[model samples]
Target: MKAVVMRNQTLVVEQLTAPQPAHGQVLVKTLACGICGSDLHMYHHCENVLSGFRNANIPVAFDPRQGLVMGHEYCAEILDHGPDCDKKLKVGTRVCALPFVISPTRFEHIGFSTPYPGGYGEQMVLAEPMLVAVPGDLPAPIAALTEPLTVAVHAVNRAQLSGEEVPLVIGCGPIGLAVIAALKARGVGPVIAADFSPARRALAEKFGADQVVDPAVNSPYASWLQVAAPSDYDMRSPLALLGLGRQPRPCVVFECVGVPGMIQQMIQHAPPRSRLIVVGMCMQSDQIEPLMALPKELNVHFTFGYTAEEFVHTLHALADGSLDAAAMITGTVGLDGVADAFTQLARPEQHAKVMIVHD
Candidate 1:
């Protein structure tokens, strides 16, 4: 099979052996796959990645240096079943799957595993238990968003958001937009989305953000405060309070941008008793002052991935247009475009969910 193979710190279109499903697994024809933030991380950290290996005391099971096929946010069609596969799935059924386990002894992240392969290729193997049927009406490209959507959904769940807490999502990237979608799906609203990118902020408003904040304009926190109503806390401190905006106070801060010092920024700016849900995948080391969070008594939650139910829910939200996920897709590219797409995603002012269509 032809795949975008990553070799020596770069991706190249190369022929590789198609993955055969093992026992209890299903072979899926790659239909559409979304390039993920983690894929970019894998591409950069091929030789020296720490997060993948830090999960366990065992040696790194997935070494990108060995020519990896990277993609996990995918929607595929069932082609065949390996021996002892589940009885429910039928050939030609469209589906989204969790990268449950790469091998019995290793972790189950699809794009990172060389043995189990990934959706970047023409075909890949998924464990039967991980498959979730994609609705017949959902377009292949939009369906590819299930995994990332679930990631946002799960983060919202971690926030435990109710109507009382105003949502302030930092970074209007894909996950941040997913947070907005999930918030809207639950009828939780009056959201404040922050980003430096004008294009991204516009997308966020279209996705149900009540107001958008440009961090470059007078400190995003100040703008957020200007638009938001105050919580019960009588914040007397000059830096924390100006009483500018009449909208609801931003009580839940979703830290979706995973770059350096973002967490600290959110922490420094968060209101008293607010919860900071960290959704961004920051691969490098960073620091935050405990003193910033201490005064406000902020609840900081680190979020990763999603649940099976949430994954299916994301699919349903997209299918029903409850989430308007199709709007999230700003562009599409073929296999060869993967390299440039990675570069473009780094400065995501113009792109949201760029689909890698299998030709």
Candidate 2:
């Protein structure tokens, strides 16, 4: 099989042995796959990512210095099942799965670990238990978004919002936009999104953000205060704490930007009692003042991947048209064009979520 392998921080097309399904696994043909932000991080800062994994005691099966086939957000067609498989879906059924293979010894992240090639290649093996059928006639490119959108779904789930807390999304990247979409799907109120990129702000509006903010001009928190904070509510006045006036509706801020100093900035600017959910993957060492969050009494929650139930819910929502994310697919390319697509994705104004379509 021909795959775009990451070798020495450069991607090159190479012929590699096609992976076979192990016991309780299924082999699937890659129909479409989305290039993830993590993929770019691995491409640029391989050693840092590896070091973090090592320090965390996360064992990776492959050596980054040699070669890695990186991709996880994908839509695929089932080709065959391995020994001990039930074969419930049948051959040629379209499917998507959580990108991991559960071995008897340990969990292998499908894209990052060794032995199991990810969706970047023509074919890859998936743990049968992790597979989810792509419902209805959803196109492969759109269905491929199940993985990334699930991240947003899990973040919203972790928030445990009262439906009254105004949502202020701090970044309008793919993850931020997905959060906005999930909030809207759940009928959560007038969503506010902030980003420095005008293009992203526009995309946020498209994804159902009631208001968009360009941090270069106006503060997103100010916009939230206008909608959520009562006119008489004053954090500075001691009298205001007695419930004498209408209290401000709490704001649930989603920090989708992983860059350094963002969490501190949120602590400084966010409304008191705000719930901060950090969804971004910051690779480098970051610093934050713990004392700043003390006064606000903010509830900071750091989120990672989704639960199996949340993943299924995300797929069904996308299939039923409850989650309209068609606008997120900004571009498509063949495997040969993946290298160039990565370059194009660096420009936020030009694209959001580029898909690699396999033929």
Candidate 3:
């Protein structure tokens, strides 16, 4: 089998031996896999990522020096099952799964670690328990989106909105766009999205953002204030203790931009009592002023991957047409073109989500 791997911090395509499924695992042929921002981060900052994992005491199975296959968001077709597998789904069934496998000794991340190759390869092994069959007539490229969309689902779930709070998504990248789609799917309204890129702002609207803003031209926070005004109790005035001033309405801000200083910016600018959810994965050290958010009484939440239930829900949503994420797939490339695709994705205006499609 041919696989594209990260070798010496460079993407190299090589012919490798196909891996057989282990216990409780199933073999699947890659159909379509999305290039995630994390993949790009790992490609450029492998040493930093590994060091961070070690510092956090998190066990990392991947050794950058040894080369690792990297891809996670994927749709695949079932080929065979390993020993002790129930094989509930037929051999030809198409499916998507959370990108991880639970081994008897330890849990291994599918695309980030060794032994278990990622969707960049033509064939990969998946934990049978995590596999969710792609339903109806959804195309492989769209089906591959289940993984990334689940992140948005989980972020929204963590927000635990009261149905009154307006949502402000602060970025128009793929993850940010997914958050917009998830908010709309759940009937959350008056969504405001901000991005410097005009192309991303357009995609945000397509994904159901009620208003889009270019930070270079207008303030997204200002747009949020227009729709969500505080009721009573002004934070700025001492007389507000008597409920004399208008307080900002409940607002949930999604910090989808992973770059440094974004968190501090939100802390400084977000409305009082706002719930800020940091969904982006920042790879470097960032500074935030706790004193800035002290008076505001802001609630900050950092969200990671989705839960099992959220993943399943996202898959079903895509299948039933409740979550229309087809617009996110802007480009597709074959295995050999993976390196160039990575380069193209560096320009936000050039693409939203690029997929690696296998024949």
lDDT, candidate 2, 1-359, per-residue tens: 88899998899988999998889999999999999999998889888888998897877657987799999999999999999999998999999999987766888998897788887899999999999999989999999999999999999999998898899999998999999999999999789999999899899999999999998898888888888887766755554334446678878999998999989888888866789999988999888887878866789999998899999989998999999898998999988999999998889998889999999
Runs in model 2 with CA error above 4 Å?
59-61, 236-245
Error of 3 at 314 (Å): 0.6
Write model 3 residue lDDT over 1-359, tens digit each, in one string. Answer: 99999999789999999999988899999999999999999998889988988898776657778779988999999999999999999899999999877656887889998888899999999999999999988899999999999999999999998788789999999999999999999898789999999999999999999999999998888778877875443445655323346666688999998999999999988877789999999999999999878877889999999899999888989999999999999999999999999999999999999999999
> What overall lDDT goes with each candidate model?
0.82, 0.89, 0.90
Candidate 1 regions with alpha-carbon error over 4 angstroms: 55-60, 102-104, 230-234, 238-250
Residue pairs in collision within model 3: 230-247, 230-248, 230-249
What TM-score, over all chains together, does every model reach?
0.92, 0.97, 0.96
| Candidate with better lDDT, 1 vs 3 | 3
- Quick one: ranking by lDDT, best first? 3, 2, 1
